[model samples]
Target: MYLRLENISKRFNSFVANHNISFSVDAGKIHGILGENGAGKTTLMNIISGLYQPDTGKIYLEDKPVKITSPKGAIKLGIGMVYQHFMLVPQLTVTENIIMGTENSWCLNLRQKQEEIAALSQAYGLKIDPAAQVENLPVGTQQRVEILKVLYRQAQLLILDEPTAVLTPTEVESLINILRQLAGAGKTIIFISHKLEEVINLCDTVTVLRRSKVVATTIAKEVTPQQLAELMVGREVVLQVNKSASVPGKVIVSVQNLSVANDRGIPAVSNVSFQLRAGEILGIAGVDGNGQRELADAIAGVRSIINGKIEFNRSCTRQKIGYIPEDRQKIGLVLQFSIAQNLILKAFKNLPFCHHFLLQPPAINNHAQVAMAEFDIRATGEDIKVSQLSGGNQQKVVLARELAGEPNLIIAMQPTRGLDVGATAAVHSRLLVERDRGAAILYISTELEEVMAMSDRIAVIYRGEFVAILDAEIATIEEIGLLMGRGTGGRKSAGTG
Candidate 1:
């Protein structure tokens, strides 16, 4: 084995994050760690990467027991981790970011480093501009820079956590190809992702984890996506949504001539016009950073638009719009606040929870208790801090809180990005239920499977432009892939025409 983790256990407070999990990866092979959100996938990777110390376990590199006490130690051991969020300094150039941690001679050669980064990028088919600042690069290119950072450090074992969660289908395929090539070149890879199809397509071997334990490990070819999903969830799961044709009502929310500028003062969303009707789910599918955030923010009334007209339905105008932001930590809920406090975030303005301009803990706790039960938020109690819950459960709290308001419109961005099979299914079911009950939903995600599975209609956004709108029933992965890449509808569109 190139790397081995035996009987690894980690505990936080009273909860066991990893319970005696064991797994191994062979050199020159891509090994997949399959699990749902909060299934200890990140914890295992963190332990291996030296972000956290395992309570009781043995880690071996090339069959030699080793101690990775810090990130520097892990780097020296030829292990590197690319986190779900890129860690590069936004102001630094790509070459500078790649060599951020490396120590060189007193006479540091900038030209030499740039040449090395360029060579590495070419070798991996990563089309990156070494001199470009990290902040100026698109998300796909930034991810490439992150991979290059690891490879430049001479890492033989790479651990990537949810690498494709922010990538479009084309970028995801490119990443897979890079991983395959890396494995062929004798690098060991451990990939963690919720998308089952990618795991089925890319991995040589797979390990399923649930509730901090390894459920099974099997050869990738021996398992189907459905089977892998079942293993991850520990139960039979309905992979597809079972919704009949949606009867879209009158336009509940209409966006006319919408234009928004990015941080660089460039038009991110330009002249965009769309209508979302009551009782329908409209999915916006796009590559990351392709104006999805601007659109969502504008629609949710969080950000001021450059120019746009938003018309809300009478019922929608009466209720506040609920938004589930893409970055949960940054926008969804306050980590330091208790579950009860976050439950009343939006509705705290006017309530019994507010008395004489102060918060009433009793009323807040009671509301949280009811909301937790209704939304199935699996946390210890209402008093527990929001940060204490697992990612899936944290998301559950956000969902429960938002849904409790009985909003007329829901703007969910990447709602199921990192969730496991069971949690994803539950979220999908809830969205469908809300859609059926006359709530207009604007679903945004990079995962094509998710957009196709849950949306009544799918709109492809590319290069900050809405390229094509297609019926979910008649769309194929190939067609969406083409649109995502070329911004031109494929054979499916030709046939429809």
Candidate 2:
């Protein structure tokens, strides 16, 4: 059905999340939304999905105004939304999850419902096992289950929020095809994502929101990726990686036949050997849960290495290394701490941040002031809590704290995982800056495109082993992908970048 929003506005306390937002989407078409973090994309989506009541606005469905005050009301009106985070119970089967809250009575026929759900899954090209538990399925399969949940409810308009964020490259391709099939079947879809190319390729119309307002809405085929980026950020944003040639220095760290185990005491990283030199960025690329975290944790002295040895060069001590973990909210910063306190976490007992066995508040605050300005952290003040900042600003706090003294080695793991395009660029710029400052950086990420662009030498990791390490400029996408899937399939020797 056709949907329209007129003069949509929402406010939380004194902050306006969405202001005078207006847009119209035709039925049986994929519409894409683009915006930076805190640009009101999520707020607008919440309003559409009936999680929020607009302070002032009118929502029109088929040119008729309707009140959607609760999620049940939205469902009754044939609207459904799948968030970035999966809302499935791991212990439940796919059939159980899809039919939740829709059961007619207490007498439930489990096997019969599973068969029905299986057919529904097959019809949409989902190919999911309705009887299998959700905990046993892959990330992409779980995503398909989410979409199936909405379809099973007979939703006419589906709003997907960053559906492809956690999916692997292969899974992403599958999801794209599934979404195309849905749109072809006359389902109105609103796709929200940070991937500009995917949006342009999938959506018929693209709308951009900036600073809580609808800035531009244009046909997807008529706009370029750079143009959409600029419209979203309200400025000319650089979507490319800008870095100088790496001039390698002395070896900073070397892992010889290193092996690591996962949390369940299972061998995750096999006998892997590699050396990283100063002033170089070596990127490890693979699918998620491919021993990336275990290896990084071992190198950072957090996890135990079951076998082999990790040798650091002179002056590369635990205190001289900067570690930016993938889980920034939990691992990178202390949520209760202020920006000033978190900035001095690594050096709290040192001279400037501490004196005479007491914490130096003035010095810590002074350092935070400088770091916030340099890192471009947009917050009200230095004393503001880290949890109060946006995702981008919180990441900036972690970067500021970790890269304070230019550590000799930097371990950056998925540094820009959930950030917007602008914040991603900032993190890339900072890491490149550290690399230029004679620091060896081990960049671990599941994002293949980002890994290829940021690394001097790209390491294809599969099953906890580096199948091939090719020079970034010479590494072909097909070769890397082959190595990532089948170990040693397209072997490329370690190149001198």
Candidate 3:
């Protein structure tokens, strides 16, 4: 075994993060770890990467027992981890970020170091300009820089947590190829992701953890995505949504020649046009940071539209729309507020939640009680701050607040971004319920599978434009992916054409 754990356990006060977890990885092989959020997958990875010390465990490397005290200590043990969110400085060059601490800054030769790093990248099939700024690179290229950063430190063991979460389909393929090359050259990899298909397709062996315990470890080739889902959630999961054919009603909102600028005042959404009806879901699918934010923000009435026409249904006003922003913590809810306050955010000035600028605690608490029970938000009480809740409960709070009234239009952006399987299913079920209730929903997500599974009509966005708008029932992943990569519609069919 290249790496092994003997009855590893960790605890933070009364909560058990990892419980006697034991697993091994073969040398130069990719080992996948699967789990729901808060299932101790991250805890285990943190222990291995020396961010935390296991309360009770023995980690064996090359058949010898070792203790990792800190991240630098872990690095000295030839272990490195690339987090889902990159830690590179945006203003630094790729070479600078890679060799930030590896060499003495005062005595460093910039050109010589860049050439060495360039050679290392080429050897591992990770091609990038050493002198290019980190922020100027694409998401996939940034990920390659992260990997090269690890390997540059002579790390033989690699831990990647949710590596493909934000990557495009093309970028995902490129990463898989790069990992294979690294493994062939004798690097042990531990792959962690919520994506079951990716784990099955790339990992040699897979381990599933549930409720802070190892449920199973099996050969990747022997298990299906459904089986893996079951192992991860401890129940049969509905990986696909089952819905009747959408009865799309009259157009709830129509957009023409829309153009919007990002936070930097540069055009992010360009000349995009579409009509969303009262029942069907129009899913905007693309890679992360690909104009999804600006487009959604414009429709939600949160950001200014540089040049466009957004007409609501004669009976539907902008105030009647429910907007679920992508970042729930930042835009959706106030962390310091109680559940009661958060639930009534949109209608705080209304009769039930408030009256004459004098807060109505009784009505607010009563409303929260109803919303919590209805939305299945598992919190100690309505008085507890929103920050104390889990990611799922936090999302439920957002959903409860947004879906308070029977809004005619809903703008949902990456609603299930950080949620686990059960929570994901809940979000989907609630959105589908609203869709059935004749609500026009614009669902934007970086997750391609999620967009396809949830939408009635699929709009493939590329370079701030809708390259292809196809009927979800007839669209293939290949067709959508091609449109995304090509970044142009060409002769492809467009919105309801």
Candidate 4:
């Protein structure tokens, strides 16, 4: 075996993040670590990469027991970790970012380093421009830079956490190809992700973790995505969405030449116009930072639109719209607040949750109990802070709060992100239920598969414009993939208006 963990465990105060986890990876093979959020996958990887010391157990490389005390030590021991979030400095060029710590000389030879990095990139089939600034490059190219950085450190074993989460389908394919090439060249890879299709497609062997423990370890080809999902979630998970054909009603939301700005006040969404009808899901598919966030924020009344008109059929007030922000911790819920408080965040001023000039704890608690039961939220109590719960549970709290009065319009932005398969299924089912009850859903996600599966009509957003809109049933993944890449080939099948 190239890498092995024996009886490894980790703890954080009262919680056990990883418990007695053991797995082995052979050299020249790609191994997958599958789990939900807070399922010890990250903790195990952290221990392996020397970010955290294990409380108990041991790690062996090449059949020799080893101690990884620090990130530098891990690198010295031929281990490299590419986190879900890239670590490169956005302001610097790829060559500068990669050689920043490795080179010791005050008078650095940047041109020489760039040539070396370019040679490495070419040899490994990981094509990247070493001269390009990290922030200016596309997300896919940025990921290539990350891999090159790891390889440049002379790593034999590479650990990647959710590397494809923000990549387009084409980019994902490119990454998979690169990984396969690396494995072919005698490199060992540990892939961690909640995306089962990629895991099943890329991994030789798979380990499923649930609630800080290993549930199963098996050959990847022997199991389906559904089986892996069940193993990770410890339940029967519905992989395919079972929803009736959409019955789209009158337009619930209309945006005419909508223009919205990003946090820096620069135009992110420009001249984007679309209509969302009642009892239908209009999924906006695009790569990250392609105006999806700004559009969603503009529609949710969180950001001011610079131009165009947003018209609602039901009411002028924002209460008629239920918004689920993309970043759950940052925008969806207050981490410091209790579950009950988060659940009543939008409805706190109402009659049942609050009396005239006073607060109603009992009513709030009662509402929380019902919401918890309905949403299958697992928590110790309503008074526990939302920050204490797992990602899935925190999302449920947001859902409970947003769906309280059954708003006519739902702006769901990455609602199932960072959630387990079971939680994702639950959220999808709830959305479908709401759709059947005549709610207009503006489902915005960079997850193409999800948008394709859930939407009745799919809109391809490229560079802040709605380039194409097509019926989901007729829209193929390849067509959407091309559109997401800003290609002109797929526009023939799209509706202009």
RMSD, candidate 2, Å: 2.1
The better-scoring model by TM-score among 3 and 4 is 4
Q: Mind giving the per-residue lDDT tens digits that candidate 4 earns over 1-497?
A: 89999999999998999999998999999999988888998889889999999999999999999999999999999999998888989999999988878887888888889999999999999888889999899899999998988899999999998899999899999999999999999999999888898898999999999999999999999999989988988888888988898888888888999999899988998898888888999999999889999999889888899999998886525887889899899989999999999998887889888889588999999999999999999998999999999898899889888887878899999999878788899899999999999999999988899999999989988888888888898899998988888645584534522
lDDT of each: 0.86, 0.90, 0.91, 0.90
Candidate 1 per-residue lDDT over residues 1-497, each given as its tens digit: 89999999999899888999998999999999988777888888888999899999999999999999999889989999998889989999999999986856788888888998899888877788899999888777799999999999899999998898877677888899889989998999999888788888999999999889999999998999899888887889988888877988877788887888777778899877788888888888877778999889888887778987888877776355888898787789999999999989877866788988888888998999998888788887999998887777888888987777668899999888677878888889998988998888999988878888898888887777777778888878888877876678664321111
Clashing pairs in 1: 36-420, 37-420
Q: What value of lDDT does candidate 4 attain over all alpha carbons? A: 0.90
Give residue 293's error in model 1 in angstroms.
1.4
Given candidate 1, what's the lDDT at residue 381? 92
Q: Against the hidden reference, what TM-scores do the models get?
A: 0.91, 0.94, 0.95, 0.98
**Off by more than 4 A, model 3:** 489-491
Superior by TM-score: candidate 2 or candidate 3: 3
lDDT by residue (tens digit), candidate 3, 1-497: 89999899999899889999999999999999998877889999999999999999899999999999999999999999999999999999999999988785677899998999999999999999999999988889999999999999999999999999898788899999999999999999999988888889999999999989999999998999989888888888888888778999999999999999999999999999899998999998888887999999998888999998988998788778888999999999999999999998888888976688888999999999999999999888999999878788999999998987789999999999977777888899999999999999999998888889999999988889888788888887777766776675434665552
lDDT score, candidate 3: 0.91
Candidate 1 is scored at a TM of 0.91
Error of 4 at 385 (Å): 0.8
Which should have the higher lDDT, number 1 or number 2? 2
Candidate 4 clash figure, as a count: 0
Q: How many clashes show up per model?
A: 2, 0, 0, 0
* Ten-residue stretch with the least lDDT total in model 1: 488-497
